[model samples]
Target: MHTRNVVSGVLLGIGVATFVDETVFHQLLHWHHFYDRSTTAMGLVSDGILHAASMVATVAALFLYADLRRRRAFAPRLWWGGLLAGAGGFQLYDGTVQHKVFRLHQIRYDVHLAPYDWAWNVVAVLLLAAGIVLLVRGRR
Candidate 1:
């Protein structure tokens, strides 16, 4: 149960999730931006900022992971659990706080949002649940 390993994994997970959101939804699909209440240029800037932050998190996580590995203190199960939890937590926050509360952005526009919202939150819950299970099991 190395705390550093879990922290590293969590950071990596957040980075991966943000990367996917930025690349797939924001770029490939032309979906909403991080801040939609602005012009296209502003949106692009916001996306760039998000991308940079995610990259920083990823690099930091990798460094931590490498250190854990070098010390032979890597806890695979705990790390994986943290990874899933972090990903799910981020998605859940985005889906709820960002999408609904702050109105930062929606999953998609000009569509029935109910289904997408439900699916997004549901998946987040599942991921979080699985992570919790793994973490509990790993403790034994």
Candidate 2:
């Protein structure tokens, strides 16, 4: 598997996960918004921006993967690793940067955040560890 393929796959996974988060949590579940300081309208705008970015990323990744496949350089193991890593990284960023550092919004409103934060970060760490292991094993 080509290294580029792995990277591309990761990008795709990240984008997809982001889209899911935006659609499910932001719109459907109504748990939280991208920026809690603003109105719901602003929140929708933020979600639109996020959705656009995710679409771009997903398209870019697919294009790159197609190119690599045409060249017969796609590697399954490495690509899977990248996918796991990308998804995990996004979750970690959301937990640490958005939820904690930025004070944007918690996983839920008027509820205990410790459990949500702990679970989010822990799952992210596991995903990252699994990705690293797969990447290393793939290289061997």
Candidate 3:
């Protein structure tokens, strides 16, 4: 596999991990709370669904990038892979540091947070921007 394929795969993995936590662990298993107690019943609506969608989208993007790479659609650059990476990277960072590290609200809770929270947000934004640029530039 090429850089794009590798990065996309990595990102997809990370995204999947996040989805499992949000949808399965958080929603299904009731391991923890969501944004608030109001979101306790996410059967109708909640962030858990969004997390699953993001995972699917990122993985789909990676799948497309991989197919294009195999066909030499954009052999030189894997711009699309970057977006997949960005999405995955954000989830990974959010999971590892924000959730696992500080135990902040189980899932993403980086709004109106502290300096470190802002720092993480900035990093996630940069990664997403870079990934988007790569994906747009590499698209064939």
Candidate 4:
């Protein structure tokens, strides 16, 4: 039940995923920018925007989680399910829509993308499946 808890977890999950993407691929690995069809300055700006948004989401989610805990209405199972689902959903969308459909950016550039694409999507699906299973179990 506890819809608020689930929402909080989902937001946190999205924030975490975005943070990881920005830090690992964009920063550490020097992968493509959020918008690759632009100058380096523009790409950096886009990354900054994405980072800000993710931070906002993380802070908001944490505040909501704190409130739920204070109220003693936190639902652990549902929250976990929501977290996994949110992360998986975001990843899947990024892998498919952002990469393929919109051509915003790819997992990696100047490389054969089939394996990376498959791995990314497969992981997303697994996460989503685990979340669904948890949600169903939590319902009972």
Candidate 5:
């Protein structure tokens, strides 16, 4: 039960952090998105992005895994897996269609880093798969 609180807090925290970093810092500080790519600090921004994502993943991964352990709750599933999965879904969608087909920079948190895009999609898929596994196990 205690683990549940900690886990939920973590998931929520990750969502908040994502909102902050993507919406606030990247947008305001480095001018990653709103401004032109040439104007943005492409190299520093991309490297920093990967670093932050790794950190978030490291902590959020545990929270999500723990949520899956618990039988049922919005906190466990929604905040934990659903949020991460949703974020991942975005990556997968962005990578598959947005990057190639649309050529949209809807959310230009990173520079034109294909490696970052690839990694994001891969991790996003893993998060969704892990969430499904947890959901399946919880049903048993």
Candidate 6:
């Protein structure tokens, strides 16, 4: 597969993961918002912005994928590796950078953040490791 396809797939995966996280945790479960200090209206606005960004990223990825397909430059192993890496990287960033550093929001309110952080990072590490392995294999 072409490098472009791999990159595009990774971007698509990241976009999908972001949307899923927003939908499931932010909207469905009402766990947290982009900015915890803000009002409900602000939170809703943040969500809308996040959704728009995700859509843009996903659309770009789709366009890249389509272009690569037209060129017949596609690699399944690389695509899968990229997907895993992107999803894991986004998850890690959200859990650490956004949640911990930026203090955007915890996994949930009235709960200790340690356990959630630990679980989230652990899973992210696993995903990253799997992606690395796939990437190595794909290079062979």
Clashes of each: 0, 1, 5, 0, 0, 2
lDDT of 1 by residue, 45-131 (tens): 999999999999899999999998899989888889888888888889999999999998999999999999999999988887887
**Candidate lDDT values, in order:** 0.89, 0.86, 0.57, 0.88, 0.52, 0.84
**lDDT tens per residue, model 3, 1-140:** 45655466445645654665566756676555534445456523556565766668666757866686678754434544554565547555765575557664553344344654455456656656666566567654
- Residue pairs with colliding backbones in model 1 are none
Q: Mark the regions of model 5 whose C-alpha exceeds 4 Å error after superposition.
A: 1-21, 28-79, 106-112
- For model 4, residues 1-140, the per-residue Cα lDDT tens digits are 37887788888888988899899999999987888888999999999999999899899889999999999998898888888888888889899999999999999988999999999999988887887787778778
Could you arrange the candidates by lDDT from highest to lowest?
A: 1, 4, 2, 6, 3, 5
Off by over 4 Å in 2: none
Indicate the TM-score of model 4.
0.96
Q: Pick the candidate with the highest lDDT.
A: 1
Predicted candidate 2 versus true structure: per-residue lDDT over 6-73, tens digit per residue: 78978987997798788888999999888777898998888888899999989989998988889888
Q: Alpha-carbon error at 51 in model 3, in Å?
A: 3.3
Model 3: runs farther than 4 Å from truth? 1-39, 43-47, 88-112, 129-140
Give the clashing pairs for model 5: none
Q: Name the better of 3 and 4 by lDDT.
A: 4
Q: What ranges in model 1 sit over 4 Å off? A: none
Candidate 2 has what TM-score?
0.94
The C-alpha RMSD in Å for every predicted model, in order, reads 0.9, 1.2, 7.8, 1.0, 8.8, 1.3
